[model samples]
Target: MIAQLTALERTYAAIILVVIMCVGVAMAVVGRGDLFAVHGWIIAAYAMAVMVVLLRDIDAPEPWEEHFREYYDDPTKVGIILSLIWGVIAMAIGVWVASLLAWPDLTFDAAWASFGRLRPVHTSGVIFGFGGNALIATSFHVLQRTTRARLPDQLSPWFVLLGYNLFCVLAATGYLMGMTQSKEYAEPEWYADLWLVVVWVVYFAIYIRTLARRREPHIYVANWYYMAFILVVAILHIVNNLAVPVSIGHAKSYSLFSGVQDAMTQWWYGHNAVAFFLTSGFLGMMYYYLPKRAGRPIYSYRMSIISFWGITFMYMWAGSHHLHYTALPHWVQTLGMVFSLVLLVPSWASAGNALLTLNGAWHKVRDDAVLRFMMLAAIFYGITTFEGSFMAIRAVNSLSHYTDWTVGHVHVGALGWVAMITFGSLYALVPWMWKRPALYSARLVEVHFWLALAGTVVYVFAMWNSGIIQGLMWRTYDPNGTLTYSFLDTLVAMHPYYIARAFGGLLFLTGIVIAFYNIWMTITLPAPVDEGAASDLPVEPPAPRAWAQAGE
Candidate 1:
């Protein structure tokens, strides 16, 4: 039993306890201002907690790690396929919603399929289903490569994939069944939410265990973002979704908070859901795959660490900016705005770092479609951060709030930054995961990139113009002290912008379908392999020392 306490296990067990103690002491110290005393107590409490957990862990036998018994990379293949499938579905629904906005009558008078119902369906499907699957599939691949070990048991990996997709199925079906909590992002009812909680916990445990067993001396930067995404999302989901189901069959339930408090909590959850889930998670993919593809080292190791911690700390407070000019305390609003503005530092620090990493690789920027996508994403990351900071200012919020300008800001991040990076990573990952030579058509990739870019720019500018026009018109007053333009007039004025947006969406959808077809052809095309296969696949070599510059 004494022999069970390996140095590594003891180290991890101690760190876990220190983390717990730090959390508790943070709460207490914030509650009271006796910092010196609290600091001393916190250190003691952390040491004690570490000892206790370590003592318990000492007797527990280490788990037996699993090896891949099957010859085929079924999980990787299936996951990639599912991610592509869901991505198309999600984008299709998104285009449908865009059309619905352009012309509300497209709902066809079906209550189950109306804009109110379908909007959430599209958002959840894309954000959770498409983006979520992509992250999981790629993380699994990256984890394996970085760790130099096979994933946990095949069954559990399957569980993480199928179980998650099953949750998505339940969620989409429940919405069609008119079952919902009506929360913006957390729309799934309690049962579905509960199901997701279980899947996510397994996801987290698998990730941690994988990292723990890694052969590398230091963890990769991508793993940091991935793990942060898993951990913080767990905390956010549980905190924001404190609800009791009326019944399993019932579609309705109440949140734990009420009134303005509820609004605060909802946006708090909503905005950070964007920050952690959408932003930080993809940033991890960018950090790992971009430099790997470019055959370049990261610009600065210190900058990456700064960005990581800065984003982790600053993002939580900036959620209140979503509720600006509301009844949330003035101090809270102030905190949100300040952090949002200051967030530009770390955000651009990351963006600049990525861009600078390409200093010697500018020629590749012209020749490599993957680098082009990633570099453009970094540029847009800088743009969106600037826009977000500007929008957080009360003066700007008064004009842009409840307008198409905000929609433009979001799409800049979504389409330009997040989707672009995902595409880049997928372009690189798909071939590597499948052991294919390269993409079927570089020309198709170029066409896809240009179409996506044109569509995004057109869509963003149209909405920006429409939103600002509407905002100004709403606040415009006649010199004789009467409203200058009715709301109907503003809506009518937006028709042209809406039409342009729909056209852009159509182009974007077509480009995605083209990409899907291209990838499909790549997979289905004939290939050659040696007749005599080795009994054991070769292990991946450790990442080069320069690769260390990316994340640590």
Candidate 2:
């Protein structure tokens, strides 16, 4: 095992271990009995685990071929594993928070368990922890394969993966410790935000370095989307999170912008976080994985190029729509609305391109659970983007703003689109990474598909109903022009829908648990032998299609 690691891996592992130990010690010195103390102890234990894995060489034995060393990096496997682990943790927290919304008494008198704190934890856990890892992992895998070039350096890949996750850890724990900049999606305080900037810059460098070394004549469409996501996110994050720290040791900070400017900045960051982080990054995943899994080439590379440019141009201006009916200037709000409405064209262009790519692969869509997941994801992308466009309109925004409808719209993208696509990609990725012929259980994949689909339907519909009802009740008027329904009356009406949403979350959580079990078994269990093969011999699966091949 030790013989297999290049000097680069050993050096990176040692650096990571030292950093972990140092951070743990620093936390102990400063954080004493706070949540940071608990975080420090966990870091120490994690360092020990890393020591054992790095020293013991738990990776499978390397292939004998020399060329195998030049094409792929193994850190992608680690990224995938972390993505799934974080997905489960995030969804579990999401379910707990949903239950809290339904029954506020569930807080159990614990301030840490309150919805405000845990909400950020769930959002960051899923967005940065789960979704971020997926982007990193898939981007690395896709960039190499599409470019037909090896990563420039092994150590940098590991550094990006571990460093990005460490930032996620800090953000999550900071939320629990009541640390925030009070920005919607950019809540992590000054220090954590600065740490992320360092990590993200390294990430961008890694992408550019790999691209510069590509053997392919033309860069693939997918990498363009990924690069846009990486670059635009860095800009948005730095601009939105600019603040003055109270002290080097303290976790508090004040925003550079105040009042209306601050609100505009936050929503701009918030909406675009959805755009670039969730939508653009995942679109990159779709461009590669969807067609690859369906055994088809992209429907129209030209259309994809158009969609890519359109989305990037339109999404940035659309953030001001989130400030509709607020103190933000009316002209700015109208401009945002127009841009958001225009965004629908490019959004559908991408979604349609994916669906059309599967034109001849309907049979695969039926038989392959992975394809089913990706197909549903594309459909949801279309639905959610259309819904978003409508909601951005001034008339529709009047009813949708501050309502569960917005929440429902988000999950249509998050749970139905982002998570489904991620699960499908991972299902495809796990077997390849572990050198297994297939997943441990195909039946479990089918079961999980249904569970996820059903859960999303129930959850979205419940929220839609709740939102519309709340909107109607709020605007209702008596003969004397008094309110027709009290706010408490609307709350009472929403109780059933809240409970239904929680049930939907429970169903989704069950699917995630099943997926985790399947992935675990795939890694740990031995491959099955063919019917007529020797007992000691395991069957190797057929090679993937050209587009699906790793490192080309």
Candidate 3:
């Protein structure tokens, strides 16, 4: 990828790295006796390392100017590899966390080894590190194809990709150092949050600039979802992360909100992070990849547009449902619940639209593991949205709140819907990105599909059973009105389920390892002997004399 870069671009890149190194040094000097100082060193060291790599390739022959007119995919390739690496690491951390629940003495006695410290690492790694990278990579690829336009500039795409990753690394390390804003998904402190804001603005600019350069007159449905994902997430991050840092050098900050308002704000960010970042971004992927892989057009474009606006309008109000039966106002809670129930229409509309798009492709889904991955993801998306809406009700929340049921519900969405769709998309994307005829092994794709399915089922069922049992035990009462089950009893009952959960997570992590090996081998496969000057896409059949080509 680096060998193709023009000399001027490489020189500009090196100059930027030098500036970053100076900033890192200043940060290191200013932030002594705090984790901020350590991150400063990380920044400086990372800048220097990338600089050396750029220097090594600085003198390579420039790429063809004609090739520059094609889609700029170097950043997408790097993003894919990085996403897989983060997925493995984060899933492994998740397995360790599950084990810790089963046996608390699993880790060495250290501050960073505690479950509290490591839990956020696992969450941030999977959500931002793994899932976020996948979104960014796919969005770049989808944007270009749907619009028939190359990215506006090579340098800015690199800035968005690597700069965003820098934020992720800072977030992961800061968690280990016990520095946090103490919010749920918005845990990274003010510095990291500010860095993300900078990265995101550039990301948005890339989207906007590329659209302005599009050859196609009408933007595709996939780009609409991607744009919504980008815009909404920017708003959510800035508003929820508002805070005053203790100092420029210190790693502490206080939220601008206090009390119930704070709780409302945090969950508002949390749930929409799921909505836009997790759901909408992946939905964009699903719209493009599923139809392409199945060799079918979307069944109803009209329904897709309707679903898009419905989801955008309703999900913002639904986040308040998470604070049900709390100190939040009754009307606000009721409003949230109402919107959440209404949200099921659009959610299921999307899910159903995807399924109906598979009208003639059911046979392909049965035979093609790649298609099956997406098929199951759609089913899970439907089921999970229904579960989320059901749980939003006040009556259900009474039993489910503060119970493992909530945890179970989250995994149903995460493991079943999010991870499944991501893997499906990558499976379809990897061969095209590498210009390969096929993956290293088709059987291995089958192996991965089954293992992932099994793991998700096992993990979710254990949580459901354990959660219900925990909730029941806590609520059990005697005739005298005293609780029959102590809190310790609930803890004791969870032991077996925790062990089951760990085993399930290990199974999922094992599938990730297998995928890593498969993808590595695919990337390393030698080019075809007759493949000179050929695009990765398959040749399309010649159309009838009267039929038009591209769809709206």
Candidate whose lDDT is highest:
3
lDDT string for model 2 (1-552, tens) is 333456556766777787877877676567675555655665676677667767775343433346344556477888988998898998999999999988999889888888999999999999989999989999999999999988886667877887788778878887876777778888877766886898899999989999898999899999999999999999999999989866544556788999899888888888899999999999999999998888799999999999999999889999999989999999999999999999999999999999999999999999999899999999999999999999999999999899999999999999999999999998987887776778999999999999999999999999999999999899999999999999899999998999999999889989989998999999899866565434433333333223334675
lDDT tens digits, residue span 237-262, model 1: 88788887554334357888888888
Q: Could you arrange the candidates by TM-score from highest to lowest?
A: 3, 2, 1
Clashes of 3: 0
TM-score of 1: 0.83
TM-score per candidate:
0.83, 0.91, 0.95
What residue pairs clash in candidate 3, if any at all? none
Better of 1 and 2 by TM-score: 2
* Per-residue lDDT of 21 in model 3: 91
Ranking by lDDT: 3, 2, 1
Query: Candidate 1: deviation at residue 548, Å?
Result: 49
Candidate 1: regions farther than 4 A off: 1-73, 528-552
Which scores greater on lDDT, model 2 or model 3?
3
